[model samples]
Target chain A: MSTTVEMVRRPSSGAEQAPPSGALGRLRWAVVDGWVMTGRNMRHVIRSPEEIVLYFSLPIMFVLVFGYVFGSGMAVPGDGSYREFLLPGVFVMTMLYGLGATASQIAVDTGRGVVDRFRSLPMARSALLTGRAGADLLRALLELTVLVVCGLLVGWRWRNGVGDALAAVGLILLLRLAFTWLGILLGLLVPNPDTVSVIVFPFAFPLTALSNVFVAPELLPDWLGAIAAWNPLSATVAAARELFGNPGTGGESWAAQHALLLAVGWPVLLIAVLAPLAVRRYQRLSR
Target chain B: MTDETSAVVARGLRKTYGRTTALDGFDLTVPRGTVCGLLGPNGAGKTTALRVLTTLLRFDAGHARVAGHDVTRRPERVRAAIGLTGQYAAVDETLSGRQNLVLFGRLRHLPARMVRQRSDELLDQFGLTDVAGRSAATYSGGMRRRLDLAASLITTPEVLFLDEPTTGLDPRSRNGLWDAIRTLVTGGTTVLLTTQYLEEADQLADRISVVDAGRVVAEGTPAELKTRFGADRIELVVRHAGQLPAAAGLVERVTGGQVHVDRETRRLSAPVADRITALADLLRALQDASIAVEDVVLRRPTLDEAFLNITGHGASERTEVAA
Candidate 1:
């Protein structure tokens, strides 16, 4: 069992006082340290494919139910396919659900005291958030792939060329990245998984319901439609639809006309606002 | 090892959570390569002192240093030198035991090859080689605590902070952990362990600090603390249950101390000032009184009674309730 060898070769490396280096060195260390943690998180995802499948199934269910069951009643801009119109909306919904993925994982880690262990180490303080963001991005990409395949199987195709299709995919990923920060903020604020799940739904429901995710904003009352047009989720969905060359096209609203710019701007703003908020919450955890 | 050098030093540490104080003027000093047990009840601030020294929590007013690094001014240096195995086993349940160790090694900035080698050695040292590939969730309570301790030792930290590390382990596991800890201390690792278990402190600490109400009530070697509290006791169980009252009266008359008797067990026990004279007099008295004694013994004061005497309260009753 090599137990004797283990006893014989005990670590002789006494605490070699590592001097606090300059800011640049610390920043460099944070990147490498974060990448190492990202590898650990990826290993978890690979070992548990069932969890990944579960995450994918929920979004696929929404696509099937909304595209087939609710398709007949929903109005489209023209004779363009309703399945295609629902594709972008379903993808945005999937990202919204992905928000819970981060919250639940962080809550579990906090409850399990893994965060305390991480805090004790000499590694970068920001590595925890960076690692979580990296893994969540990977998960978001996987969810995007599965949803795209489901869309194709249901007769929803990206009519645009490969370049535009990639752009739309990028837009969806960007929105997911933005929500990841929100997930982190919520996770740090609420340490219970059940409470995080409960809180996420209320925010997610209103954000998705009030936007152009499931249906055209024109179908709502004028005031509600105006509000929906400016909702960040609406920008991403509209931009993705336009890029994918789907049924829905640009609308008269300024946000809808410049959907691509708004799509990029919204996530950037969300990241700017929530990233620091999450980091501050994390720093205050031990205090 | 110099007289002037202490692995961990804290003075006048103060901390509060809103209105309630977690630490108040708590002072401690542990010489290098020694195990200083912070013995206290549930809310007596043992954990708080450990947290402050480990750089996990900030103190409101105090000067604390870990491995010669001021915790508040040079926290990174303190963090680099210390290791902490908290009350709860801090490990990922989904990850395999070996994976958890490797991840921590990598985070400590160990070289890639060294990370793998050290992880293997730790797994083996903790007697987890066979189950290294298994998820930590599948491990027994003892195995999990060992893994947690192993993770903290990835870099051979100078000052290891153990905050109730054996709180929930079975007897066998607790002993195994204690052995592992002893080996580390022998290898020159300074340790600060906090525990509510008097037996744990008595068995492991070179010096024990009895903490109460966020401060140190008493500090001394285990033997010294026991001696300072009170003298040893003489206990006797009569051969016949009916002779209990007679034995109790005889013991009180001989020792001139309060005798406590259990009527059901026919057992009587009382404190004795001088061990040899008291034992001799008690035995001669029992014989003169024609009392048939089943058993007689003399024992020193336990850390439990000493702790109760010092703090005026028993240690946390959580473990007792669990038992």
Candidate 2:
């Protein structure tokens, strides 16, 4: 113990000087701190092999269940195969379910006092949240890559040109980015991490069921179809089907006809509204 | 006021949540390079005061300065100068111990080259070098706390805030933490510690501020606090319960203080000013009175008794529910 005390008595040789001043310096530090935090989160994902397996398995199971188990019984609105139509919906659905993961991770960090340490540090106030958004985006991209490969194995392909297919992938990621913000807000708002799944599942299930993920909105009843057509999830799925030239493109409703417009508009609107709310909630935590 | 001689100063800090007040008129001043202990039971606002000073939570009204910067207006400057280890160990459980320190160093704006070097140094100093590559989740409670403390020290802070650093640690680990804290103070770092253990405050703090119901009810050095409440006392147990009254009277006459008698225990006690002489005088008088004394001892008031005298309750009593 005396040796331990003697060791601690050594002077700290790497004491940091005060942070740089001025707006430019502050912005630079924000970016540096944000990147550091992002790396920290990425390490967690890499080290937890079991968590990665669990997260990826859900989307893979969904791909198998919807693509093969129900493909023969399901009907497509147009001439294309049902798996082609189902793949786009599955891609969009995976992004929507990702909201649960984002929320629970944030909640767990908050509960464990990690956020309190970050709040007390000299780092930029926006770094924690922006870092989370960055990490979630990267993880979402990985999920998309695996799902895309699985779709190919199940007889899904893009009839449209490569450029349109790439654009469709862009739209899917944009929706994911928006959902990331929503997850962050929900994570900060939840009282505990255990409750995030409870709230997220109830909310996400109804949303996916009401949208055109499993069936075209045109096949539903008049009122139910109108609600499904306008769902934010429907906008992204409908636009992706159009770009991929898959069957089950939505009917002539304004939301379906202008699928590309709504696809971009909905995510932009969600980011615009939810990002500020999440930031505000983070700033007021434990007040 | 941001004075050069003071590392921390708070005046009338007030914080409330809905109808509950967590801190009310909490005031403190800690001199530079000294340790000040905020001693209190649960729900006494010790953590709340720490949060306000560290700029983690806002107060409804108050003025506080840490390391010469206003806590509310110049929070970033305060944050740059201080480190906080919260009640819970805040290290990333998924990351290895070395990675946690490096992450905090980078976040604190240390040079990339220096970050790894500093982390290795900290891991060695904290006796965690042996397990530096293992994930923090696999570390024991004591190791995790040491890592948490090391993370806060990525750069030597001018002041450090430790909120109950040894709350759940075993006796050996608690002593190790105390020695580590002492080493930090010796190296010229001012520390503000909060704890529910009176002995911890007595052992490590240069001064202690006893808190109750969100305010500092008493403030002094450990010895001064004990003396302020009262001096040493002579307690004796009579051989027979029938002699308790006689023993009580004899103790009063010798000590010149009120004697408290307990018939059930056959014991009598009275405060004494001149401890040795009073003890000798009481013994001689009791012998002359033919009161059979089974046992006698002189004892000074513990901080627990002083706390009870000041707050009108024991130190372990929870006056209000709080986080």
Off by over 4 Å in 2: A1-17, B1-4, B235-247, B261-268, B276-298
Report the Cα lDDT for candidate 1: 0.86
lDDT of 2 by residue, B50-87 (tens): 99999988999879999988998899899888989978
Best by TM-score: 2
Candidate 1 chain B, which ten residues in sequence have the lowest lDDT sum? B314-323
TM-score of candidate 1's A chain against the true A chain: 0.93
DockQ of the candidate models in sequence = 0.43, 0.50
TM-score of only chain B in every candidate structure: 0.88, 0.93
- How well does model 2 score by local distance difference test? 0.88
Q: Return the DockQ of model 2.
A: 0.50
Query: Which lDDT value does model 2 have at A85?
Result: 89
User: TM-score of model 2 relative to the true fold?
Assistant: 0.92
**Residue range B110-228, candidate 1, lDDT tens digits:** 77788888898888788899999999989988888889998998887789999898998888888888888887888789999999899999999999999887889899999999989
